[model samples]
Target: MRNTLIGNGVIIQHGGADYYNANIIRRAINNVRSGCFPSHLYPKECADFVTALAKEHNAALNGDYDRYVFTTYDKASLKDFKSRYDRKHKHSPEEIGFEDYFLLFELIHNKLGVKNPERFEHSVVLRRMFLDSVFNQGKIETINERFSDGFVKWLENNDYIFTTNYDSNLDVVTRLPVHHLHGSFNTLSEIYDPNSFRNQLKDDLLDGEEVDLNYPHLYSTCLVSYVGDLKSFSMTQSSLANIGMKKFVKGYQDSPDIRNQIDEWDESNVLVKRLKEAIRLKSERPELQHSEQYPHKELNDISGALEIIGLSPNNDGHLFTQILENENITEIVFNYFSHQEEADAKRLFGSKNISTRDVREFWLDVDNK
Candidate 1:
């Protein structure tokens, strides 16, 4: 009763169910505030947090004591610290996630004083994160020095990669094309000068005098933009208003020439055109374009399969579906983490070529292939 791949014409649509897999701001926040680590207030609350998180998503421990070693404290300093700490600290996704979250929090709470403490107390871990003022303040620059090639190496060991097309060469030949979805954390400062504003103001105000205001705002804004709620323009509006941004917004909004120029600004520089071109070329000649010599293109083809992996399937990229349908894809293999996701994928693509299975088995089959 199942369709099968019998020839080159038969497109074998295989999709691995993956989360966005990025250490986004929200995941980072929950990792820090999840109370996974013991505190004076919640002394025996380790398993509770870990268990809850595990039920929600899959976690792998390459080493047992990894978490303990990484996040260790002086046990001898305390009298009642009897539980054995693993000390191996394998850098859980949550752990890395927390660090990213805390950096954003520091940008906002420490620099911008713009955190919703009330929301923090009420299942904050479960809520969707928004790009806040701290993000708009450019705090991402603070972590630039810390994010070197070494971090990329560590991320490879941990199965995390940058999704962006630029920033580093990142052995595109062998490894899973670690797409740093966002721009590189390090290049951010160079891309947007941290002290550009202060330097300009000083130049305008003092003519030639040496004026230096520690550009913490620059760092804060970078971080804020990285983690800010892009859907709402309120944060940027308030941010601009605070720094006398009325003229800039008005000029951009009012001047016809400015508006015309703005339309040409490719502000995000998302590389959509390049991707579309690649897809068009690949679709035209799948044999040549999908060759092993072009791993990035192959990955793109994999990502563009009828069944999506980490995507939420809001149909934002309906073209992928159209391509699959037009090619007459009769079957799709999807690895679902839970029954709910399997049911959901089935409901959404039931009329098409989608079949859900356990992630573990899917990987096993992949290995054999």
Candidate 2:
């Protein structure tokens, strides 16, 4: 199958996708207090953490803070951002939304430059801003241009699409299969539903059955949306590095203390163990079983050439690493929008297996053809 990776950049040009863009999310974040946060996101234990941070950030800024929030895109350099922000902030079990802020911003913010508010706990009264901004975004849509047309054609040829975007912009416009690497609003919201068919399959998914998705891992991973300029990978080092999945790293600690194995986690003990077995069943287990029954895992086993567009090198490190290591994938066609991005693609993908293209040229050809 031919495979293509669609990134956030291509959809940013579309109007419907503007809802989840940083500006909208940021504005909502900077505005609400909720008496107790979004009706859905706030834990009864903690009133509101994320909303309060925005209020405080607002109080601290004598002038507009927007000018400064976006200035430092790199997390390493963000240390010098403010003496107050220098220290690493931690989240408690009640402070779940704040940690989520760190994770989601990396995936969705793309370039809108959202800030990981310093001292998330201080904003306990902060409204749950993500759901507020995301849930109300009417309908997300994308059109048949800018490779959407070409992507549609490729679907007929059995090409696979893997996108890091959380919105169903492509799904709305094309109704094609889009594997959202970090998860999306639709999937996440459905899992929350008590009666949804996907939610009903939760147990089967956990039991390593050909059943769809349960919670502890994949569901937890995608439904989670945190708001950050901290960069997605940098924010969740504890989850990915410690061998615990980032989505399950929600617990009370001055800093997140994730375990190296699933057996150690006591929260959803059984489901967690089953999640490990499920992943193990699909990941390098002796049987080489599970196979295509696991469609998400199959995203990695791309055998034909890969055509990539709009994917950020920083968003999903582990997946990118696998793509680099996969021998089945013939060549990576990395598309860039500018000279600087061309340089970034060169550094990230290297020359050994990748050939670069200017996005404008490629799509113009597609639209022309």
Task: Put down candidate 1 lDDT per residue, 123-190, tens digits, no spaces.
Answer: 22222132221122233223223334442343344232322221233433225444333333223232
lDDT of each: 0.32, 0.47
By lDDT, who's the top model here? 2
For 172-282, candidate 2 gives per-residue lDDT tens digits of 655777777656655533323444332332365323422223221222224232323322443343234335422333322113343344435554675555555444333
24: Cα error in model 1, Å: 11
TM-score of each: 0.29, 0.52
Look at candidate 2 and tell me the lDDT of residue 225: 27
Find the number of clashing residue pairs for candidate 2.
10
